[model samples]
Target: MATLSILNHDRKIFDKKYIYPVLSRRAGGLSLGINLNTNNACNWQCIYCEIPNLTRGKPESIDTKLLKEELFFWLHEITQNNFLSNHAPPDTLLKDIAFSGNGEPTAAKEFEEVINIVITAINEFKLNNLITIRLITNGSYMSDQSVQNAWSLINQTPKEVWFKIDSVDNDDIKMINQINPSLNATKKNIESCLDVSPTIIQTCVIKINGELPSKKSIDQYISFLKNYEKKLKGIHLYSLARPTEQKITTKIERLTEKELQSVADKISVLNLPISTYI
Candidate 1:
């Protein structure tokens, strides 16, 4: 078996279909990742994205049959054998089945159907009680009915949504995410998700062009969190952990551990639990 470590997450582990695994820092163990967007496409081209040749658009089509086959096969291996000990570090354990891949997974045409398929497989394999089902999304398509239906189903299980909220300032958002996303729309979408389930705010704070986000930018972000404090699970404050393939990589830099902690301190004022992954 190939050695799998959390330190290396750039390469696809399985190189097959939509299923793969990684030692997730946020998850604190081995995570089985479902990649619905095999085409390497995304609606937003985040400057710090690690996906190579990242382009604009949603996923074309998903082969649900193959996806089901791959997911069940891997689940059996992970549960029935010593797959974790053989590939990952000794302390690692299966944490969650995460929908996180090359792009926004909710953009897939079969988003709700895919979620149902995963849920069915989890039940079939009797892994529903053992692992959590998680969706790591940018929260772009959350307002869509299909996506909302999927979220409703996911809320029934031991699951969470890692909703990305890098910055609240529209200009900063455009600069970082490389798209013109409506601030109000994003907020509404987040609220919609929170209405059904608690969400973890995943923020990736980094230096762009050798400068940290301005005080105003940080203030706006804090205010945004303040509005949704009651509905949030916590904040996942992290910095860049992998090298990027985007052209803007030259302008991006990771924050130091101290800097990350300092930012966490600022957010701590909101009184939400924070997990820092610097």
Candidate 2:
């Protein structure tokens, strides 16, 4: 007999379709998730990240062949079954294949190769242009030359990049991301990506020390966005949706749907296409 751990690293239950759960508030319906940092590695330790056993970043390689095979098998199951019906077959429906897991997918040295692998798998399933290949990234790797090149190469395949822009003030950003990259540099880097692909700024609003983002902080972030509204595809404003790993979890809370809508309304007043996800 083997000892059982509910959260075993190799105990993923989903197969043939990467990771399950096609419906999501953020990514929308049917998201085929790609977990690049299966080992739970990441550069930034966001207080809100949901991954357990989190570690630093990984420079290791992934089994691309196994990944492609798994993805195809999963898609085959969903398409062949009554995905959303009560008597639905044993397949999970998906809307898109999203590169979102424990860490930044772009941090993988073979990031470019993995993008090709996903594109090939999607085409094999005839999903081609119907489904999106979304990259949910922290935006830190965007400044790296090789990482940017990987994204550029990925442009050959149909996809979307959701860049995280949690805060505009340096101190606030440092508090959330724990990184010290210059805000001006990040804006320029994101602008660079816009030239190549449609980029959505994904922002998360949460409370700190029992308080929401200060009025000054929110104003600065909005002001920053106003300047790049023309260059951006849109804004994704979402609050916390999952339990956090920080010991101070009690200190944070998700903004109400109404509160989020208010923020969206302000952004709309700026003439920016802003969407709120609560």
Candidate 3:
């Protein structure tokens, strides 16, 4: 049977449209996810993205009314009912309500409104101290003021942003994240994220055509992160946990524990803490 476990990675644990739950390795427990990209659209076409039929576009308009309903219903189910006991493993805590779904959540036009709805639900359920409100984002739209304002309202609950920094070199970034980006713009967005909330640099290192990241790429990444050593929370270095849906799947491979640790050890030059997930 498909229940919440390390092996059961299905995103849809229920029939809801917007909200679902998952067992997150980084989160260390169950993460209630809000998937705004019901159309499965995104601004980037990352090579290691797992979303099938990935396209280059923004998300369709969000139905904030329906989203609020789903968020509240799930919060009630987890907090006031026996949903976790039945679906999740024993002793598993509700880790966070993560804005991670099929694509970049901030692409939705109603991004700020959605954050407001989430705060309302978290307040009603009184999950302020027990769980965190997490935004798993690519840091592309972190510079927008409306998005920053939305994040500022959550004073009662603990909050964190998993801002992705897959690569610092533009060439490697275009190949990995599949976007033509300026390093300056990337740094500016990350700085914006730091101003709004606690930020963690989330990186995905993947083997392409049977080779790991080049030393130059890793060096650039480490140097870029050095600038935020004091301002940021920490770093999350992970490889592909699930298979990629992009066309280059034949060349992509997961990192072994030794290889992952080696990269982590090299990144230890910066004094911040680092966590690895496979």
TM agreement with the true structure for every prediction:
0.96, 0.86, 0.97
- In model 1, the Cα lDDT at residue 228 comes to 88
Worst 10 residues of 2 by lDDT: 1-10
Model 1 TM-score relative to the real fold: 0.96
* Every candidate's lDDT: 0.86, 0.71, 0.87
lDDT score at residue 29, model 2, on the 0-100 scale? 49
**Candidate 1 or 3, higher lDDT?**
3
lDDT of 2: 0.71
Q: In candidate 2, which residue ranges exceed 4 Å CA deviation?
A: 1-21, 82-93, 155-157
CA displacement after TM-score superposition, residue 6 of candidate 2 (Å) = 21
Q: How many backbone clashes does candidate 3 have?
A: 0
**Which candidate gets the maximum lDDT versus the true structure?**
3
Provide the lDDT at 207 for model 2.
Answer: 72
Which residue ranges in model 1 land beyond 4 Å of their true spot?
none
Per-model clash counts, in order, read: 0, 7, 0
* Sequence-dependent TM-score of model 2: 0.86
The full ranking of all candidates by lDDT, starting with the best, is 3, 1, 2
Candidate 1 displacement at residue 199 in angstroms = 0.3
